[model samples]
Target: MVRASTPSTWLQGLDIPSQLFGTTGGSDYELYEEDDEFVLTIDMPGFETDEIALAWDDGMLNVAADHTDENRGRKKTYHRRFRFPKTVDDEGIAAEYTNGVLEVRLPTADSTAQGTEIPLEG
Candidate 1:
């Protein structure tokens, strides 16, 4: 089982602009293994394709999004990171975002755990 970090509650409990815009609430994500691949699903309520960015570095997957309301001067940003396992094929990973959800597919590397049977000498 894999779990992503959640937004700090202490940050949301405070009443400051910097806190509100900084470490406040964030989008939710779910991860699971499917066949020979791992799937990640994130919920993004009000974000455009252009506002989101994805990156992979140091065996970690990073996602960041920023949004601002022009008329209200309100801004919100969401960021999340996921660490890939050694069995994952990071090079072939793919992602797509639509209908307020982001989906990432990470294919697993070729099976390397082989088994061999040995006959007992009588």
Candidate 2:
């Protein structure tokens, strides 16, 4: 599913029942900037790396996961989106999942422009 830049905007119209079956549900996540990389940590227990999907488009980061609890005969879906600030380098983003936590790293914008000197002739 496509998501807007703002996460709350898409969560307002959530369908609870459908979400329990196979639709997107609200998921908890944390975003922070540290050193040269922006970090995003999301809680997604009971899901394998292959069952999750991620996408970055138009400055919006989208994450979705689906899994079935066969022992309980229940299915669940978790989804979230974040609007990255212009300071992020979208092209260098990377993700890794370990011990049920998904961590994404987004490098800071290149500094080449910051050091550029423009000459003015008036």
Candidate 3:
């Protein structure tokens, strides 16, 4: 399942049952580890690349965007924070925004996964 970038608190009061799912109901981003790197992609429409800001700090990634439309007198804002499981190469981190999509890659320091896996008891 694709998780939403930010939790939709405004939809929580809706009558629809799916609204209860909030951020978990739909997907606007994809995250995975490949080739010794962690890749995170977020689909953000109606915002320019310049309006978006990405920052990495202390094993956490922060994504924020703000857009203002003076003609329509409206403002849009987005903010999300993510914490990775393993140690990442901070100097090797990179990001790109194109066609309203943001993609970030963080190189892993080693091949081992951070935590011990729990055995599934069915």
Q: Name the TM-score of candidate 1.
A: 0.69
- TM-score per candidate, in order? 0.69, 0.66, 0.72
Task: Name the lDDT of candidate 3.
Answer: 0.82
Q: Number of clashes in every candidate structure?
A: 0, 0, 0
Using TM-score as the yardstick, the better of models 2 and 3 is: 3
**Cα lDDT for residue 31, candidate 3:** 87
Q: Which residue pairs in candidate 2 have backbone atoms (N, alpha carbon, C) closer than 3 angstroms, thus clashing?
A: none
Deviation of model 3 at 23, angstroms: 4.1
Q: Evaluate all candidate structures by whole-model CA lDDT and list the values in order.
A: 0.81, 0.78, 0.82
Candidate 1 regions exceeding 4 Å error are: 1-27, 111-122
lDDT of 2 at 28: 58
Across residues 46-104, which tens digit of lDDT does each residue of candidate 3 receive? 89888999888899999999999899999999888888854899889999988888999
lDDT of 1 at 120: 100
**Top lDDT hit:** 3
lDDT of 2 by residue, 11-106 (tens): 558844444543333335667788898888887889999999999987788999999989999998987778876667888999999998999998
Question: Which regions in candidate 3 have their CA more than 4 angstroms from the true location?
Answer: 1-16, 20-26, 111-122
Candidate 3, after superposition: displacement of residue 25 in Å?
Answer: 6.8
